[model samples]
Target: MDVSLKNRFLKSYFSFSVGIWFSAIISFLSVPITSWLIEPAEYGKATMFSTIYSMILLIVLIGTPNGFMRLYHSVEEKRKLLWSSLVVPVFLSVIFFGFVLLFKDTVNIFLAGQKNSKAHLILVFAVFFGVLQTFSQTVLRMQEKGFSYSALQIVSAASNVLFVILYALLISRNFYAVLYAQLFSNILALSLGIYLHRESWFPIKIDKSLVKEILAYSYPFLLSGVVWWLFGWTDRIVLRMYSTFEEIGLYSAAFKLVSVMSLFTSGFSTFWYPFAYEQYEKNPNNKELFSKTFDYISFLILILALLIMSAKNVIFLLFAKSYRSSAYIAPFLLLQPVAITMAIVVARGIDFAKKTYWYIISDGVAAAFNIIGNLLLIPLLGAKGAAVTTGLSSIIVFAIEKAASEKLYPVKYNSKRAYVSMLILIIIASINTFFERFYVGILSSLTGIVVVTLLYNDVFRKLMKSFFEFLNRLKSMNK
Candidate 1:
């Protein structure tokens, strides 16, 4: 095994983490601004509309962007594949968006408590920008443009925070802040994506063969992404029907807050793809890379959830008490990051195995299970039920993916390391959350963070060394 490759992966991991850290920091800091100026009801509308828009995003984008990653320059017969990837989704989005617009009023009932008329208008731009952001980021990653991806995401996040601060704190009093911020962020990200496309120097030709492979790969992704959106975002819609708009607002706040943990996986996942592909291409049997990544990610996500959950009281004290009671949902929500990372691993493995359809099948089964679980659980359990349903489906889907992938690419996780660390962090969260004793919870959480740190310590040191060397090389090039 090449030590340098290991170091490179670690360095890449840190860079990815730093991006998420910045994004999360800005998000945490934005709370005070949001809570002070935007009323919970208004923010709730923002959340609801956004959630509806999220569902639309999956339908509009149609998963071609993700499929492009696997079918990029590496595949022979690239042109047809590229066209297949791009043309079909572009046409589908037009039809999808048209359907949305035609039934705007009925959809508005599902999407918003009060129709702004303008809200529907905003959705157009939001979905348009979202496709740009998604496609641009995908293209960047396929070319192994990690730094470009990171930079664009950072820029988008920063711009979003700035515009949101401007609107929420300075100018507007309503959900326009969300809309405006989203618009600006998407435009900025799309621009960066365009810039990186030029910089990456990849061929842009699209053709039939490329499209065939892309479609073949992306059909599973398209279905999976749509199902995931439904599974993930359905709570707000469900709550909207059964509960008050304000309740939906509270739930949205809680939901978005919990989603913060996803920064761990999202920030690194795109970047990890090329690294993993390179590793597999070079040394298919190097179990250490996958094992280490899993353990480190497991440790990383647990620590993230612990830190967020540990500081829940303080956060609630500052934001809204309505959300305080909802903190109980934190435990189930923490499972999401693990589930997402695991899902990514499993999905990738399945694709590697050439059983892409099995992925679609697995997710379809899981999605059905999730919807059924939600229908049964949500009326009684509320948002908590939705969280549990989402998580259970994720585990089920991941298990199926893992099993199916074994035939094509046999891989094993660091089971002992993952299990032990996972248990430790879960215990830590239980102590911190269940006990009323703040000092004990606080101390135990800190200790737990340290323990999690220890799990990734070797990787962390190697990362630091690699980073400094990377920086040094950059400095030399500049000179």
Candidate 2:
């Protein structure tokens, strides 16, 4: 990589990542705090509300956010493109909101695990506002307004924490606190998002032909979205069926801890799509950048996964004693983000080639595997079963996506070392789960670290040399 290009990529990445890290830190801290305030069953019920919200968001958006990003630089009328993306999703969101109202009783039971009309209404509004927020964020993302985007993210996360504290202090301290806090926070975040992108999306007007074009590109993702949801959330749904809310709560807690991995994944994905698309447009044949990026990301994510797995017990200590068992479940759950982050890098070819349909096949197969795994395993092992199933399903998704992408636009990614590192991390996770001893975790972590370091020795040397050179440059500037 050129020095200038490397500097630009690092600057852009940190511009987005800094905010994500702060927001994630707040969210990370809040998980234990919320766990302390709410019981396991109540926390589990709150998780269900988010589950329903995510499903509705997926249906209403129908993948238009991605369509907008893909077409952003290609189109001259970028504002019109933004408006085109928003119109249909907002319309669909209204219809879904109405449906929620019409079928309030059923939605209440399914979403809240009980019939609370107020909570149901709040969830409906949350999804509605969330649609607007999605487009607003996408606009910032596509435009590379990293600072503004990061500010919005931080504000949203902070407000949610504040509201959760307020609700617990003044309002009822049950699942309602969680549900209500989310609704209020979404409203606040949506308002800020609209304000941030006001110049881009205000005076919005429909572009019928453009809307049709964007929809054509994004429609496959609609089917894929549903399947993707199934792949991601089937464990929760299955857990709801076969296990207690307490078990679900424990699982959700573990999942939240694992989501610290998403701090990097989400920030990277948010940046990757726009960056990758732009790079492809400029040099369609430059495969080395993609290959090198994949190797570096895989190396970082694998190392992070191992470290998190080793520290799971210590991390879970912040949770209430009732949630302590979550430590065991969290190690394998690390795979979910690892797969997602790497897939964004490895599967860039699919998006570049406009082969969105591959997502359907990849997610469909994984979802099927997950459904069967959950059915068989949740019956026997409870939350641990779900964690293991999710981990394995993630690998399936990554493998299928990588193969499809390679067929579309071949990149000679040096994947052998990544695979070896992943295997070592998996073994360490399994040991940590079964042994549950501090010394055992330490020994396994040390072993995995040694093996991964040896495997990626060349990459590490390059990074270290770059770091010292960067430091020398700083010293020269100071002089």
Candidate 3:
């Protein structure tokens, strides 16, 4: 890529990353406080509610967000495209809401894993608001309104923390605190999102043919979405069967810690999606740019993984004594976000070719592996088993998607380096999880970092060169 393109990429990435990183920092700060306020069992119950909410959101949205994003630039009638993308999902969500109300008893038992009518109703409304909020943010992302998008993210995260604290202290100190905080936070964020993007989506225009076309492209992902959800959440669901809510809570805590890695993944995806589609539209065979971007991202993600592993013990000290055991489970869960983020670049070819169904094959196989692994391993190893299963399943998904993407749109990525780095990551994670020696983790992580840096020395050299060039430009402009 040229210097100008590199500058644009960095500018856009940091714009998104600033908000995401702030949001992550706030969430990280709140984790210790929240874990103190709510017990492990309560946290586990809240996790269940979130899991159900995600399933409903997936079903009602029917992959419309992806469709809207994919077609945004291609379609001239932007407002109509927005309306068409949202109308069906809104209709489906309403129907699903009514169905949930009608079968409240069964849903309360099966979905929330508890019999609470108020919580069930709260969850139903959450899904409704979630759909609107999701699309509103998507609009901000597609328009490249990075500041507005970042503001929305910051507000959402901050508000959630405040609400959780207030609800826990003033109202109740149980799972309801978590659930109500999310519901209200969504309302606040959604309201702000609509206000921010009002001009773009106002005077909603619905086109029947446009709706059909968008759905035609997006509906396949509905199946893929289900399997993808399974791929991501099956470990937690299966763990619920073999373990106690306390174990689930510990596992969830570890997952939350590992989710900090999402700062990179979320920021990258938010910027990369629209950016990638726009670039591909301009030049279909821009393989070098894509390959180099992948290498840089992979290096960064691996380095972050090693650092997190090295600091696992120190980070876990923030949590309460009951939750500290989560340190053991935190290392491998890093793979989930790392793999998902890397796949954003490596798997763009699938979206570029519009082969949405390939998602099913990749996610389905990984989800299947997760289910079996959790079933067999959770019985013997409990939460650690689920963690191990998740790490391995993530790798499976990444490998399959990378290969498929190569066949469709061949990018000459340095696979040997990626694979070797991943191998080193697994070894370091294993040592950290199984052994209590702090020095052992530090030594392994340092060694892994050195080896990875050596493997990507070219990326480092190019980045250094770019930095000096950027500095020279600044100096000349000043003179």
lDDT of 3: 0.87
* Model 3: residues with Cα > 4 Å off, grouped in runs: 32-46, 105-116, 165-177, 240-249, 321-325, 467-479
Q: Tens digit of lDDT per residue, candidate 2, span 1-479?
A: 67787787777788888789988888878987897788878887888788878888889899999899888878888888988988899899788878878999998887667675576788778888888888877888878888888888888889988888888878767888888888887788778877756788767677899999899889889999999877777898999999999999899899877778888898888888898888888888988889888877888888888888778888888878999989988888888888878888998788878899999999999999999999999999899999988988888888889999999999998878767777787788788777778889878987887788789888878888989999999999999
- Poorly placed runs, candidate 2 (over 4 Å): 31-46, 105-116, 167-177, 239-249, 477-479
Give the RMSD in angstroms, all C-alphas superposed, for model 2.
2.7
Show model 1 residue runs off by greater than 4 Å: 34-45, 76-84, 97-121, 161-177, 199-204, 234-260, 303-322, 361-393, 416-479
Q: Whose lDDT is higher: candidate 2's or candidate 3's? A: 3
Alpha-carbon lDDT, every model: 0.68, 0.85, 0.87
Ranking 1 against 3 by TM-score, winner: 3
Model 3, span 1-479: residue lDDT tens: 88789888999898878899998889879988999899988897898899889888999999999999998888888899999999999999889889988989888776456676577788889999999999998888888888888998899999999999999999889988889989998999999888867888799899999898889889878998898876777887888888998999899889877777887888999999988888888798888889989999999998998888888878889778999889888888888887877888899888878887888888899988999999999999889889998998989889989999999889999988889888888888888788878799788888888998999999878878878988999999999
TM-score of 1: 0.78
Best by lDDT: 3
**Model 3: pairs clashing at backbone N, Cα or C within 3 Å:** none
In candidate 3, residue 249 scores what lDDT? 84
Q: Candidates 1 and 2: which is better by TM-score?
A: 2
**Native-referenced Cα lDDT, model 1:** 0.68
